[model samples]
Target: MPEAGIEPDVVTYNTLIDGCVLTDDSAGAVALFNEMRGRGIAPSAVSYTTLMKAFASSGQPKLAHKVFDEMEKDPRVAVDRAAWNMLVEAYCRLGLLEAAKKVVDEGEGRAAGRGDGKYKRMYVELHSRMFTSRHASQARQDRRRERKRAAEAFKFWLGLPNSYYATDWRLQHDGNLT
Candidate 1:
């Protein structure tokens, strides 16, 4: 039998927070976190990471970043690789590549010794995705430029009658399609 009237500790609360993440419940996670603190249960790194995951899964990077900032500010906690990874995941979920890159660089500096195989893999994957996205954006711009150039050429050609426009075509100023 369990001890009667035993209050939930950080570990128990963390499990609840993780459950919130699995169910895509950001608000519930936040509420549980607040309640845990209200009851003087010091949040561990896992607690923070799980709550951040809840927001990240819900596509709320701003909220996830807020949770990360709270975790970073907690003096009792030593920010870990998982926490850093979750922060990156939050930004990446929203396609915020620049923010994720900044976080990765910060991680490289702050958690350098803590970087494991997982962090290395994520770093490589993020860079590859960024490279692909950049190239894709560039290709789109190139196609758009080509299309604009073609349109301008057609407009120029339309303005000419055998390489020259009628003088009167340029003179029509009121309700003119020329």
Candidate 2:
């Protein structure tokens, strides 16, 4: 299209990216997204959603999360329910049910205030799929194990002798262990 003297706008780039995503060409979609940014075309919510979907479909939920984080940090980009839906889907696909549930809960709260039925409906669908998934059990087990490890580590740290803390404080503050 550029060769045809038809300058690609944000919509054109989004369409190309969507095509790349649909064809399972996530790398190509990313390249086009970068090219779009390089050309000073600001990506809309749809652009980010498309890229997130591509990353999700490619089994790179972490990448999708990174894209979602970027969208959240960019004030120029308006994050709508569609972006949230994609993120929830990505987390669900990665077996991160807790993370997906967190997103769904947050989306539900936001939707409640906006009176948007679409957001609520999407949240319900994703929540049901997440809980019913086989990965849900694994996710729960992993979270429990993580919490147990964290508590044990914390207890060990807290159980250290007061003398050790005093020595460390003396070394830093007085330049000598008392």
Candidate 3:
């Protein structure tokens, strides 16, 4: 856009934000978003959704929620289920099962569009992430418990007073002990 002497607008920034998010560059996406706002470009749904997805995929669901909240307050930007699903998937990937389920439940209860086959696809993806996160978290917990038990055993041994004694012969001859 700069090369063509066409000033980059909100849409341009949004496109860049999507690219940055896809590449896992949430910071770059945020920077571009701020730059867009600084240039007095009113963000559209595209801008908001792109940023929301960026934050969600970056494991910052709170930030994504903030964007979604603002999107909801602004009548101009339509709140789409995809944005919600992005956040759901993010939370699921982080092992936040409740939050992920909340998103899904909200969508279902609120009559959020089925999006034809897209809703189910997103649901399956989110479910997969939840399972992966749960497995990974459980594995980590098991390893931690094992380490704690080993450490406790080591401590117990170290804390005991050191002593020595004869075995079989001393046991038989009680009078000749010491």
Candidate 4:
């Protein structure tokens, strides 16, 4: 594009970063991000959110957190509900429930003043995930208890006197031996 005298803008760079992230090339995305900044192109919320999502999908939630932190510190970037949602999702994907809950709480607090609905949705989703996890754990415990009960019943049947092994069935059927 540069060779054709077409200058890359923020949107162009963001698109390229999105492609890189989709291809699992976080390094490429970061390089493109830095290049955009070097070229005096300010990153938008979409840029940071894309980067955070890439890092999260790559199993690097800490890097995602760094991206979120950078977004927060940048005055030009508006950390919207979408950005917060990405950060919370990253934390949740890593099974950092406490961290995700913190994000949800912060989002709710901000939403209360701004009247935004996205933050409320984030809170609901996080709570749902927590509930699902707890329910799965309870199901596993119930299965274990069921297996224990079955084992105990089998043991009791084996210990019953005069049930099968304690009586000689052949002798009882025929009084005289052949």
Best by TM-score: 4
**lDDT tens readout by residue for model 3, 1-178:** 7888899987788889999998999999989988998998888887888888888788898888888888889876777757776767677767887787787677666664544554446445543443233456777767655554444443332232223212122433657422
Q: Model 4 off-target regions past 4 Å? A: 113-178
TM-score-best of 1 and 3 = 1
User: Which residue pairs in candidate 1 have backbone atoms (N, alpha carbon, C) closer than 3 angstroms, thus clashing?
Assistant: none
lDDT tens digits, residues 1-178, model 2?
A: 8788899999999999999999999999999999999999999999999999999999898899899999988899888878987998898887887788787777767767788766447435543443333456777767655554444443333242233434332344757422
Q: After superposition, how far is residue 142 of candidate 4 from its true place, in Å?
A: 34
List the candidate 3 regions with Cα displacement exceeding 4 Å: 112-178
The per-residue C-alpha lDDT of model 3 at residue 90 equals 70
Pairwise lDDT winner, candidates 2 and 3: 2
Q: What are the TM-scores, per candidate, against the unseen true structure?
A: 0.60, 0.60, 0.57, 0.62
**Candidate 2: residue pairs that collide:** none
Q: Each candidate's lDDT (Cα)?
A: 0.76, 0.78, 0.71, 0.76
Decoy 3 TM-score against native? 0.57
Residue pairs whose backbone atoms clash in candidate 3: none
RMSD of 2: 17.0
**How much is 139 displaced in model 3, in angstroms?**
45
Per-residue error for 178 in candidate 1, Å, reads 61
| TM-score, model 4 to reference | 0.62
Model 4 is weakest, by summed lDDT over 10 consecutive residues, at: 154-163
